[model samples]
Target: MADKEVQNSKKPPSKSVSVVNKTSSVSEDTPKTVPNKGPQVLCLRILNSLNENMKSQKERFEKLESAQYYD
Candidate 1:
């Protein structure tokens, strides 16, 4: 078992591992992002939905406040 452990730790004679240890190789001079027209449309739709929800909430709050006048 000890002999096998030693043999396993050493790389196989013919194999050389090209290890990439860096997070990114891109330079600051390169463009940070590629253009995506799809995500922009999605983001606009999300914003519009959120705005609708906010209006609904505001109307509900006003209704609750009006109901509290008699209490």
Candidate 2:
């Protein structure tokens, strides 16, 4: 039983290594291409909105700081 467990443990790593090698070779042979633009468009929209929000917050903070300095 102990020998069997040791043999079984050793077998899995070799099998996994071969699978990883095959996948890496396949990806290298395939040309990279964008499958869809939907996710990309959504991400850009979210980023733009966040950027606008940050600009507004910065302006508001500056106004508050200037008012406090005047007082």
Task: State the RMSD for candidate 1.
Answer: 13.2
Each model's backbone clash number:
0, 0
Q: Mind giving the per-residue lDDT tens digits that candidate 2 earns over 4-36?
A: 988878765443343444421222333334456
Q: After superposing candidate 2, which stretches have Cα over 4 Å from the reference?
A: 1-36
Instruction: Give the range of the ten consecutive residues with the poorest summed lDDT in model 2.
Output: 23-32
- Model 1 weakest lDDT span, ten residues long: 24-33
Residue 57 displacement in candidate 1 (angstroms): 0.4
- Evaluate all candidate structures by whole-model CA lDDT and list the values in order: 0.70, 0.65
Off by over 4 Å in 1: 1-36
Give the true-structure RMSD of model 2.
12.2
